[model samples]
Target chain A: MKTVIINYGAGNIKSIQFAFKRLGVDAQLSKDPEAIEAADKVIFPGVGEASSAMHMLKQSGLDRLIPKLTQPVLGICLGMQLMCNHSDEGQTNGLGIFDVEVKRFSKAVKVPQMGWNTIHNLKSNLFHNINDAEFMYLVHSYYAEICQETIATSHYESEYSTALKSDNFYGVQFHPEKSSLAGERLLKNFLNL
Target chain B: MLTKRIIPCLDIKNGRTVKGVNFVNLRDAGDPVELAKQYARLGADELVFLDISATLEGRKTMHDMVLKVAEQVNIPFTVGGGISSIKDVDDLLHCGADKVSINSSAIKRPELINELADKFGSQCVVVAIDAKQIDNEWMVHLAGGTIPTKHYLFDWAKEVESRGAGEILFTSMNNDGTKSGFANEALAKLAETVNIPIIASGGAGTIQHFIDTFKIGKADAALAASVFHFGEIDIIDLKKELKKQHIEIRL
Candidate 1:
């Protein structure tokens, strides 16, 4: 499969590419719309401030092209948060791929819920062989509230969408690339799908 | 639920692991990448590579080591030591390092924290503070706790957080090699003082120490070197104990 990880000068895309390489797939990093459109699987990744990342997306015009793609797209971390309707981080609007709004965790808990967390309530084939309450590494300050598009839930202060699915589009707040064996399995499932 | 993290820190010099790591069935124990892979397989939540290389050439080799580790290992790892500028962090991240921990450099110029946080986002920026208690005051130290600085531990932590640091890796010099236990009193104070995650480093000799750090210190993560390197504690066994204690570990 021709896998292309959209690189728009956001956060670290090399780790994602390396994860695919470890899985025996040489995923290409491309900002070229044509190369991305031609790929069988497209991986959308982002790390950093929402408004700036969105601004970079607009600069490269991937912002307009990503939501319209038909192939199975996986958005990770801030990439997943940017797929929603809007984010409270920097007061930026998302691509509206997932019907949810992103909000920051309250002071009752840590602002950025870092380290490993369990994802349960699996509802999509993206999870496939993954068991419920499996550990996945997550590092984020903002999160999307549980909604219809939420395929998996994790509790920090309360339940929030850890993974979301809208038809062919899949978004996970956890870094499957950095999530060890189970994360690798999820990526393999995505490739199979 | 977000489980506590167990990190195994590897001290690197010229891209080679400095301390002797006794991992059975490993061909080369000095190779950081090999050791990192072993740690990931052994269920270490995260890995920290503290590059202690002094020469420019040694620093250059760290990049290659990072690339190799990122290529072979799937778990998240952070590269630290001698990282002073945005270019240094950029090169490491491009080499596939999940995060870059800044120590003396961030202390030297506090603006470096804000600059990094603004450029790379706070998630990728980790500020490592090495401090020791002096006359009932936790004073931040430099050069691996040799040179004392005027900044207090809690004040420095709060400063870094206000400057947009994502996490703080606090190592108590007094408790580091002693391995009696983590400085839970200071750690708990730091956790309450900052809104971001706190990584308690040093003084981890047993499984119970890990438990105390998490429960008493209220640390989001605990980091150790000798205990893990010398085979004094097995990560799986320790995590199992933590799980049994209802501490929310990823066993």
Candidate 2:
């Protein structure tokens, strides 16, 4: 199956591409709206400033094309936050794919939780092979506020959405590419879908 | 909740894990890849490989070792020692290292932190500070904790964070290899001050020491070398004990 990873001026695109390559999946990366919209699946990944990222997406018209995709789509890190209603990172508007808010972690928990942390309260097919308390790599300062779309949850200063799911759409705060076996499982599950 | 990490640090010389009583009289611990895989199976949250000779050798054999370790385990691994430039970081990350740590090079050239952070993002750069307490004030050390630097530990830590360091791996040179306990006072000071994650290194001898580092020191992670290599503390039992102490872990 063909997968198009949105490459709208964000970092970590190569790492995610390399990860898919390791999994023996051929996923193309593109900024062209046609290539992304025509793909069998889509992935949105980012690791930089949110406001500028959305700006790039809007400039490329991808910000509009992404939400119109009928096929299964995945978002990672800032990509996930941008799929929500709004982001605390740049205080900017999002694509509104998921009915939730992305807010920054307070000074109490520290920003950019960059390491291996356990994941629990998993509630979606994305975690088919994973279990409660499984460690997944995470590195983010903002978290999605809990809503009907939340599939998994974690806590630091308070309970928040670690994973989000809707029909034909999904997002995760953790980088599944950087996350080890569990992350691989999540990607494989998304592929199988 | 993301699980708190338990890390075992290895100082590799000539591709073999080595340890000493106090950063001297080096004794071989084991092969780098073998020890790293062992830690992974024992539920270590991560592994740190500090190349004690990377700077002198001018080659990153540690990166090669991390490539092998990454293939063997499903956990994250960080590489330190002898990282001087963005090219050094690029070589290591390209070799499958999850993080690259900077120490002496960063002290000599603080801009290296900003450069690496801009190129690779702060999530991949870790600044290691080997600190020694003097007159109740912690000072940064360099040259494998052999030389004292004028930079104050806490001030340098905040500076690194602001300058875009993703995390700080704090090692107490005075307590290193002493097997007594972590320098919680210094760790708390750093953890309390910075917005980045703190990995407490040096002087970890017992499982309780790890617990102490996180509980009192408030470190995001704890790194021990001799205790794990010498069979004093098994990573598996250590996680079990940490969990018993109400600390969240992968196991």
Candidate 3:
């Protein structure tokens, strides 16, 4: 399956691109609407603050185009946060597809959770080959709390949605691209979808 | 879990990697960009390029070289030498460098670390402290291990972290190029004193040296040069060796 990775300048797209390439899948990078619409699968990978990311997406009209997509689209990290209704990062509004709000983790812990954190309560197709409470790489301070769309969960100071799924739309708070074999397996399962 | 990193140090003199058994031969190893690409492909968790040649001519090429190597490889890389200001850090980051290391500049202006940490966040700035066993004390050295500073390493490491450096890269000049294994005592002290990650640099010869650095030295990472450049230990094989020893690796 051809997977199109949205390259909107804020994401760590290279690693994700490389991950797909390593899996022998032709993951194309595109900012064009037709290319994205034509793809069988899509992955939205992002890093940086919500406000700036929203600005860039709106500039390219991707903010609207993404929600209309019917094919499977995986939003990673900031990509996942951006798909929600709003985010605490930069006090910004998101695409509102998931009807959830992203809030900042309490200051009781560190800002960026920069190491291996486990994903419990596996409840999505994304966790097919992965085991419950599987360790995945995490690198964000803001998180999406458990909502109607929540599928898997992790916690820093309190429980948060580590993975969310709604129809063909899926979002992962952790980077499957950099998470090694588990990450590779997730991407492979994505291709099979 | 995120694995402990294994890095290969490439001392660049003019966009080329310089290698020496005891920092004396100074012969060319190859192109820095090619070596960096090879290392990344061969399972090097990270790469360190120290600009040994700070000549006016070489100085300008450093940033271009950084961009060149960063473009070819998709891995966390750090560039050091002649970094003095936040603007320098900005330039390197714009060139796609993941981290910037400060040497003499940090000692000359300790606040530069704070300035960089404040601007780009602590994750990008790495404080490279080159120290030596001087009179039974670990004294920080500067100008590529030529000059000395009053900053005792153990205390200075605490100070650097407070200023917002993402990590501390401690190199023992006396053991550098000596291949006598890393300064275990120095590394252990720095690791114990600092809460952040500590990259052990200098005095790496064999695969065992890398192991000992993480095991006995308690280093978060190990940086070596000749042993890596000369193919004494291939990076992938080295990581396999490290993994066998129960050390975490990306593989």
TM-scores (chain A) of the candidates: 0.99, 0.97, 0.98
What CAPRI-style quality would you assign to candidate 1? Answer: high
What docking grade applies to model 3? incorrect
- lDDT (tens digit, per residue) of candidate 3 on B67-127: 7775566556788888888777777776767678997888888899888866666666789
Weakest ten-residue segment in model 3 chain B by summed lDDT? B67-76
Tell me the tens digit of each residue's lDDT in model 1 across B1-251: 89899999998888788742221122223679888999999999999999877899999999999999999999999999999999999999999999999999998899999999999999989999999999999999988788999999999999999999999999998888777999999999998999999999978888999999999999999999888887899999999999998998888
The candidate, 1 or 2, that scores higher on TM-score is 1
Query: Just chain B of model 1: what TM-score?
Result: 0.95
**Model 1 Cα RMSD, Å?**
2.8
Q: Over the stretch B1-251, how does candidate 2's per-residue lDDT look in tens digits?
A: 55678888888886788876777899988888888767766777778888877454435566567677765555667888778888888777767677889998999999999999876677778899988998998989887677988999989999999999989999898999888999999899888799888989888988888899989999888888888888888888888898899986767
CAPRI band for model 2: acceptable
- Weakest 10 consecutive residues of candidate 2 chain B by summed lDDT: B54-63
Stretches off by above 4 angstroms in model 3 are: A1-193, B20-24, B56-60
- All candidates' lDDT scores? 0.92, 0.83, 0.81
Model 3 captures what fraction of native contacts?
A: 0.04
